[model samples]
Target: AASSGDLNWSLNPTYTGCSITGAVGSQVLSCSLGTVAGNTTLPVIHVQSATTPADCGVVSNQATVATTNGTGGDSDTANVTILCPGLAIEKTADAASVTVGSTIGFTVTVSNNGAGTATGVDMSDPLPTGPGITWSIDNAHTSGPLSCVITAGTLHCTGSLDAGETQVVHITSPTQWTGSGETEVNSCLGGTDNTGVYDNTAQVSASNVTGTPNASAQEAVLCPDLHVTKVADDASVDAGSPIGFVITASNTGDAPATGAFVNDPLPTGVDWSIPEGGSTGPLTCQISAGTLTCSGTLAPGASQVVHITAPTTFADCGVYNNTATFTATDSPQTPNDSDSTSVLCAALTLSKTADAASVNAGSQIGFTVTASNAAGGSVGTARGVVINDPLPSGTGIDWSIASGPGNCSITGAVGSEVLHCTAVDLAPGASESVHVVSATGNTSCATYPNAASLTADNAPGLSANASTQVVNCVIVSPPSPPKQHHPAVLPNTGGPDGRLLGLATGLMVTGGALVLGDRRRRRRS
Candidate 1:
């Protein structure tokens, strides 16, 4: 039996067995035993171990011995020795955002607050597996290709702290993480002598055990999490104006946010901005190297904020719909803190255009009425389709009622009425084009080559796109001067080159419509 620092206990070599010892710490033990022989003293085996620590063998707080004390009249005393490990290192992450294919960073802090100087102590975090995550540490944190200057990283780390000393570690290299599962990470790490006493470097590994498990400290890690949502739930916007909204970042798990962020593809007519509190914010935002570090130092229930600016004006008039996703992640918790929300936009602006701005005096003039959006061009589709713009004077237009009109089949002057169209149930970002044909006057009237403007609405409340097409009646004129009539072929009377070009262009024109259905553009004859 022996007395160690602050505690006293006894054990007889003759005991039934070595009594189970202390808590999960280390200590020093000694014992004395011998057999009486050769007159006075007997032979004895004085066995001593350089280091006898709980972490070395008999792994747990329990210990074993060779002497199972019985009734053999063998009396002896032995001391149990315990050894304390070197120093410990810790880490904390200030994650601003976590998005797919992004790197997370952790501000690692290593401290040797206990007695005993450790030669090489390394602190690091493990890379989580899933859709888009990687493992990377800072070069400064790791000394050379395989060394960490400050007892932290995967390789040969240098001098460690004495009692009450502190150090730092920074992790980098990982980006593009999937937001589907958990992200496991690690914290304080170390090992015994690297040259002689080979000890496995300590680290935290992903426990295959699924389901929501609690967190561990001594074995540190960055548990993952994520959340996504819209600033406001609505998605409809005026065609010509803009509406404001936000994309919030949140965490709804036991682990704090590691590398967190959110990206919303602004629906048609809708536009999304950047995040705040990060190195890059305001206009355009991005997550850079170690931007979203996961250092396993967040207490449960901690959270940060990200700013999202959305405008409804870009959304074409009609119920505009879209989706916004928020992702909040912590290391180790592979894909954690995930939430998604559907967004909506209201029809804000109103307007439309005619198929043709001017119709012939006695011929049919086609007008295609349409509803368009003013803003949120990317917000997707709009729901409602309503239009009501008045038509101009002097031209016959079937839609000339509200816009100034006559009959579906009639030939008149240049006067048209107003027109109104309503298409509810229009899906978000959805649109339709309606055609209205009108007639014109006879060749004898001044309105023969009629002129009229048919105002229309693409999306009520939004801006309008208008195209003007003029139709002149077939000419009923006196023959040009003998020379001009036959051009240079008949006589010498000549016309201006511009007039000739105009005539040539008119002669080349034919009744043919060309509408290219394409995303960009194409060359067609």
Candidate 2:
């Protein structure tokens, strides 16, 4: 017999000669045999109907047998123990995949599935590390008597749960996502895959149970990164000269980047033309309204280059710093690069020419100095143009501003003086000249060399040299006059007339004495 409201038991096989009877929670068994042989055994087996946490620890069962008429009886007892309280945990996330910089939300549920209440139960979910990653627990949204807290980047919950009871905990990063498990900045993984993957696991255990079931959730992160670089063929370019620019753009993320483009505006007097191949990869380029634009799509780890051919005839002289920006669908910010090139305009030239290569001693010689601004490759005006001509050290040289379209002037005295010609501004294809006339000094059989230099505000300086030879001691013969025949013989006017003699005498006084002497000798013969 058993007490009321206790575990019940029943026999598996019914014995033909025995009978069994019992209430719901209490039962009894009886067996009878007539004239049983000595040392013969009779089977007695029983099965438990139900058990609970209250029935755990030290349980016992006893059996008694009696021979016909209760002549003899024997009893035996057996003891057994029962264990209870088991824990199980499951984890789930809101999304299976997310962008590199996005946050994720997770839910963890722990249940006590065993027959007894579980005390001192603990649940832990450790977060993965990434760029700017953070984790937090949402206590307000949690269920059950569990108190959740975060320490060392992990979320922990501890409490007690009754049989068939469950505790729900919500995990997230409050800084970026309030209801999510954690927030990640997604600093690139730095590989061709351009992806980040991690797993979050939640485990539950109780004081009575050392081992428990744990669940995990996996997530795959993805994003696209864009980068750009720009360079020029020549840093310093002349006006109207061809120049080339190279622009390189790439995507380092796992996903493809779209709507990628570059924008560049040309400076004044600068012309642009599409390159021979246009652009590399899947890019197309065009120039409109002095602005160049190139667009294309970029695959993961793909790069595109755009070459621009431009002729620059800028009217200004300074540095031209150009910047190009790269952006993509998944890029959070624009990446930009800059390349600078300098332009030099206006071309000025100077030249000096003497009227005669040789001159008599004491005779005046004339020289002309010219300064010009070339037009073909020049875009700017030559401002503050100045031409300087240094003369021989003597008082016989005289100079004056010859001709110019711009306001011009000449300063400085003769001889040891310098001829200075200045203009406020000289346009391209414009020129100015200064005439220098000098009297030959008493020193004969000598040569005088002169040099003139020019400079402009927008062009490099120039210099020119000219030389004049003065010879007064050489005897040069004169050409004979043509003979005349008038039917008969005419007067010897070609022989040597008084006028010719006077011409010879004047020539002798002017360093042409050689001609005069030759003429006189011919007349005497």
Candidate 3:
């Protein structure tokens, strides 16, 4: 027979079972059997421990059944083990700011915690998108043994991380940014542990992480601009005189400008001349149909200069205007600039002539004086023009203006008179004439010389001369009739003898008639 006693049951803290009446390492239970059958089993006891243990080594739990009837005690033990793996990842960017049409780089680093090695590690980074921004990846990764590739605008990487080991992946944006404002870049890391435990444990998972360590970059874009100026060396010039112009073109933008050129229309009434050596500065310039074109290349904040020369052809007095326009590859519709100049020149001429080359003394002679304005550029008004006609000093000649331009005054008298004519204004291509008459004085047969002169403002003086001839006639008287005296004396003697004869007179008459008849007959024969 056996007396009633207590049995003790003990288990490891890692295990749990139905409560026994006692503290740790000292639990007690009463044992009794109502009926003993052949090979019948006592009331069964159970114990259990968690599948995963806090420590990675083997974990154990024990239970002992002892009787106070002075019999031996029996014990049983159970074991379990736990596995853990951790992974940590971080991503960073190379540049904080970038310009349009420029690139940016990114680097990703993955680290492992000391619990266990992480296997089948994978990383993904989606590129940012917006207006004016084009994103692309430059797979230049060299940080670790991980291989990185980009597809569908997303960067994908694959590798493994051992305990306390790390791997790296790299990505670059090779396209230019066209948009503005702040852009966000997000990435994620994921994998599984050797114990088949996923890293999707919590917000900060032991193996996988999402939307962390985002990098931001910036971009800027700009446009090109330009400025132009035109000027002339001389503001006023004479007709047929050369004038020089200097034109400058400049680029005010950050980029180089191609096909930069300036177009200038030649001023009216001006003739174009080839520049020195057929070029000005380094510019290629040409003039066609009264327009001048100068072309060259210009860089940012760079300037080019061109020179042009032309001669004035207008014959009228007025202002002339010239303009130039500048253009470039990047810039269009820029404002143009202009410059102007004046021309001043005049030409005058004088001439004098006589109506006849020779004149008779005591006859009227005519003289003519003319003034002309022959300027080739512009019509010129000649002022204070005077015509001086001084008759021959000793030729006994008198003169006065006749059929002339009338604004003339006669000074001095007759033979040495000076005719002064005033031409207030003379237009270009116009002529003025004055006529003077001179009377010759009675004198011996000789040649007389006469002259006239003219002077005017802004013109050279002129002179002309003419001559006249004087003539006299001579007469001779016939010899007196010396024989007539003898006939008169013979007639008086015949009168005394008239008394002796009527008969004698008859005889004398008859005798005279006979004698005259006989002489006439002899001559006829």
Candidate 4:
């Protein structure tokens, strides 16, 4: 019998199987064992019967046993070693170009290609044009020949590189833009690319600047100028009448002449007199103002003429002289000029009023007057220029009111003795006057109006006014007298023209920045 989990030892004689060997008293035995963990017993044991009754090495009591080595589990172990690359230089930028005196940028990279990591990498470079380039540690851009080291393009670069880690070095050159040549920048110590760095220079050029380019720059222009001349009409004339003369002014300069005035100075014997308001600027004759004042602009080589009548009574008129003075000034450019005509004085002879004149006291009568010039100007060849008939002595007029209407008497201003006389004359050799009708205000009087003179010649006893009362007159005589013009000098040493010449001669934001890498020392594997 057996229980599931229990062990029991038992002996059975019928199931015996055994073997044993011993001495003479030895015997054979057969035995069997059961499941050791659960059953501990012998199935049977057979032994040979021998002389010794107790010879069966008798298995005293059946027993069970087991054995195991004193060991727990399993264990194993392994070990190994490795290496990284060393630090080496690298160049991101090898070359560049710029206009002369200009600037450019580049980069240099350093890598830790070694067995171990490296820290605090540095970089730098050299320059030819020292002032044109700057070196940066933690590469930074700077003017003048400079060198520097960088970490991430920064000057304040503080970086570390493990084995195979890389840092970049930057380079920048700001030039002064001067030359037209080229040069190369070489890698000195920390060349990341191990190549060349260079900047090529070019020449400078310029173009014309347009309109008011510079504030103080003046506007440029060309000026114009002119010329003038004067001449008499007749070859000769009587002693007491009128003379003829002409003035011609022209533009002769290359440029246009504007704001100009023509001045003609009158001669002593032959007066270049002007009308009441006609005479302007003290006998410095003006075409418009009669005394030589004119308003106009003249083109190059252009010409104009002024006709004049010279009333004369020959007290002294052999040769009368005069001249045309043309002055001009223009705008934009500086300008100055003055011109004049030639000189001449003519002769004259006077015829008196038959020595003693006779006329009705109440009835108007007349007298004769004449004039002449050696330069060929004439007036009254016949009758010796009678001082117009009936009106001579009877008329009354006022010379005071030169232009407007006013009370009139035969009396002329300036108490001119010649004007006082009913008739008067002024010629070179002959000077005389005549008294006609003695009537007071019975008829109009005076050969000329209250008129002053345009150009008057002198006559003895005849007031300058008496013979010169034709200044404001429009109608003119032919064969003008030659004016004893003092041919206007170029006014270098004398005259107001020179004084004016003396007066005119005088005039005398912020952006960002990029930096470069660390200074890395290269090492071998």
Candidate 5:
């Protein structure tokens, strides 16, 4: 046979009886055709591809056979083609923009593009680098691979792919990105059938491919944080005493802070002062309607401190408290700090009085003594209260404590005894009274003076005096008259003289009668 078409025909090695006469490209075969009554067929020759290269695409071949050196000969033609493997790759990203400290995802697909199966397939991708961009492959998302590794910012994967088969890979962005408006580029390539391609944009390589495929992504950055606190120098203070306070503000984020201020409302019993000094910036402070405001600025990781003085002037005893707040621009929430203090002192009073101004001797006189504390609740309770009252000496009065507190006792004689009363705890605004009864002594008719004194712990002594008057009276009797006894024997001597004169006259008359009787008897005879 002779060469006929553009296709080159060769002799097969299995055909032992036939051989080529000229060069292989000349395609002239020398073989024996035995003589026969019917038809005879010779050994076969192979047809080679001319239009298609190896492993590129399908190549068609046509062969013709004809009878030579004979009339009315027959001819026949036949066609065939060749086939090879192909590969392709593609890449995609989940996001184009993200914040700092955020993660981004990427996916790569490797596929077999030819009709035949692809073996020993390999895929690789290089890490993306920019002003603030970093990347790494995610092992959890890589699938259908014999072996995979990430070393020195590069990912390598090996596996096999069938006809029209595909494989995928996933990667994540870096943990930090500080650059603003920076772009990140990534790509992937695959190789199979001992062939590969290199990509410029993705910076990756793939087998059985021509050009590289890649993807790009970008991100932005933003960050801000602020805090404040307050404290007082003293937790408790006396009335009208000065108190000091310190307030602090800080910015701990990666961004600057503006329009930051501290607000504090001075309580009713406090008098506030101007702000002293601060750090990181100049501080301006103002007070209006009992509210104090201090303003300043702070950079990243910067702080400010402010000092203030306040005086307390509360009328009664109690507790006082104050709170301060902090605010800033671009901050939605506000924070507060607070402190408290107490004010106190001690006050006491004493008084004495009597039930009557004057009293008779040996009569009872009543006296009342009172002790009180004038401090309110803010100061606290008074402790260790005592009272002493001694009866006066030589006052002609006997005195004793009749009714008093259970802790009181009397010592010495009634006329000069000392009465003592003690109280363990005397609460503020509370009072105690001591009653004493005194009786006058039966001594002389004169005026008697009396006095008593009261004394206590941590207090001054007080005294009171009183006097009583006594009366003395005198008695007298009259004298008797003298008696007379001579009237009883007065007239006996004058009556005896008259009786002697009468006896003499009677004797003369008797003598004259006897003379007349003798003359008459002589005439009758």
Candidate 6:
């Protein structure tokens, strides 16, 4: 028997009682047998592929046998098929977990694992299906020179890969690829999508080649984005005054936020308390170690608010910053907010006094106006300190700064009715004064009240008043004229006898007129 084929072949396990001879492509087998009956069963002969290499395609083997008794010879042919080259696909996600409304990048790689090139290789990926989840191709990462398109949310790519070669595509396009095929897609999970595990699959195939099983990758969807803000009721407040803060926490994500909380550390040396019903929504709050913490669950687009109240006196007379932080379960990052308020501690007292409390309305009066900041009761400097004394409408005033450690000046002329003194700044325990002398011009006598006020930056206005009394002057009468001597009148009494009679009459008339005039004058008085 003789055999020949395109592919190298040989007998298996050495057929006993038979001798074989040939190279890989051709072989011969011969066996000795005594006379035997016809149609007898013979030992089976097995043929196998040899080590010599062969091309891929159908291969054939022909064998011919002859009988020693002059029986007819038999010839038959056998064929074998050879296959090579393989196609495989792998899918991968950039992240194992992704937040809602965030982009999810994916990569699909097709490889040829066989020794020969894979022809007409193609890949298809329909992508994962979920609410508001869209897809596109990453043109830059996708293998060049390959025709690819997305049809009805499915990715179709056609190309050829050499042995051990790979072609890659990134499934991240928001829209169909343009002519250049380099435009990237910004596919993202919608904020309204449900949170769960999502899987993506891809497959590869080629002409006359079977591809590996579909490749898959899983990505977990997580949503818990929290935002927080803090707001103060007052930007600036006087010392010893009450202050309030409002804190808000909101969940702006697709999924419900659990175990969400806000933390606020109170200003140093300040005592804070959350009043009853201060917190809104389903939130429970507590204060410990001068810090306030509020915890609750929040659905998407839900928010919680809390109000904090404290006294400004506990903090110094300066800007105080308060911050709050928000955190939640499954939230990769936390958000915080802050607010600043100025605390004013300068406490000013104003006093005005007239030198003479009883000064008449038409008299000249001197006044002393003093403004002081309490040494122990205040903190920080008082800026833009001003003292105003609007005098009576008709009265004229003169003012001068008595003493102060600051840029001080008096506005208005010396004789003007209005007196204004301004001091640039005044430190705690500092004082400024102004001496004002005013001429109360002609006016009805009466008791009058004079007032002065002081104002400083961040400090409440203060006013003080002093009163002055005016009275009418007393009247004095002149001394009476010397009275006529009666002793001289004795001579006049005798003279009334002769010529004295005429002279005496005149004198008597004169004396009568004088006495009448004196009585009239006394009545008038």
Model 3 per-residue lDDT tens digits across residues 230-334: 887777664445676777777776545567777888776656766666453445778889888877766667776777776544353457678889876544436
Candidate number of the best lDDT: 2
Compare the candidates by TM-score and give the number of the best one: 2
**Ten residues in sequence with the least summed lDDT for candidate 2:** 174-183
Over 235-264, each residue of candidate 5 has an lDDT whose tens digit, in order, gives 765444666666777777554556778788
Model 2, residue pairs in steric clash: 105-180, 171-180, 171-181, 172-180, 172-181, 240-312, 394-415
Q: Each candidate's TM vs. the true structure?
A: 0.26, 0.45, 0.40, 0.23, 0.35, 0.41
lDDT of 6 by residue, 1-525 (tens): 333344455568667666666774565566554555788877777767632123465666666777787877788988765545677788898787655445676888877777667777678887765544677777888884457888897888887777788778887622111121244221223222533556778887777475345798877665666799899988876666767789999988766677787888878756789888888877788889989998878887888989988765423466768999988764544789999777767767788887797764457666788888777532655667788877643333344444433444456654445667765566778888767555554343455567888876556788999876555422223445755433232433444223232121111233112221222111110
TM value for model 2: 0.45
Choose 1 or 3, whichever is better by lDDT: 3
Runs with alpha carbons beyond 4 Å of true place in candidate 4: 1-221, 269-290, 330-525
lDDT of each: 0.37, 0.67, 0.54, 0.36, 0.55, 0.66
Q: C-alpha displacement of 245 in model 2, angstroms?
A: 1.4
TM-score of predicted structure 6? 0.41
Task: Give the alpha carbon lDDT tens digit for every residue of 1-525 in model 4.
Answer: 111111122333444333333333222233443334433543434222211112112223222222343242232322212232344543433233332233345454555555444444333233223323453433242221212333442342234556655555445545331222254332221122321224222111111101111001111112343455666655555555566556666665544556666666555555554445422221133433235444476666666666666566545345555565676544212222322222223233433232123322223333333333233333322222223221222234222212211211234333241222222333334433333222223233224322112123332222122221111112222433443324344434345332322222211101111222232222211
Off by over 4 Å in 5: 1-319, 322-334, 337-347, 374-380, 413-416, 444-525
Worst 10 residues of 4 by lDDT: 209-218
* lDDT score, candidate 1: 0.37
Those runs of model 3 whose alpha carbons end farther than 4 Å from true positions after fitting are: 1-14, 17-222, 277-283, 314-319, 344-525
Worst 10 residues of 6 by lDDT: 516-525
lDDT of 1 by residue, 1-525 (tens): 222333333333333322425442234333333333435543332322233222222222222233335433444554443424344444444353333224555554555544444434444443223322233557655332123432323422345445465655455434432322244222211112211111222231111111211111211222334444444433433343444344434455444554444444444444544334422222234423312222222234444334443444332334434354544443333222322233334343333445455555565554555544334443434544445444444433343332322222223444545445544434445444445545554432222122222222223244354544545445433333322232232122134332332211112223322222212111111
Give candidate 1's error at residue 318 in angstroms: 14
**Number of residue pairs clashing in candidate 6, backbone atoms closer than 3 angstroms, sequence gap of 3 or more or interchain:** 5
Could you report the Cα RMSD, in angstroms, for every candidate shown?
25.7, 15.4, 17.8, 45.6, 25.4, 16.1
Q: In candidate 1, where is summed lDDT lowest over 10 consecutive residues?
A: 188-197
**Mind giving the per-residue lDDT tens digits that candidate 2 earns over 1-525?**
433345666556656566557775556766666677678776655545455545566566676877766678888977665546778888987677665446656889998887677888888777765554566667776887777888887888898888888889887642111111244244344212433555788888777665767899866556667788989877766544566678888888776666767676755455667768757777677788987777877777888887777665435455667777877545554788888776657667788899899887777776788887778642446667777777755434455544443444445555557776654566778878767676665444567788888876556778999988777655555666755333332245354332322123434455434444433322211
Residue 363 displacement (Å), model 2: 18
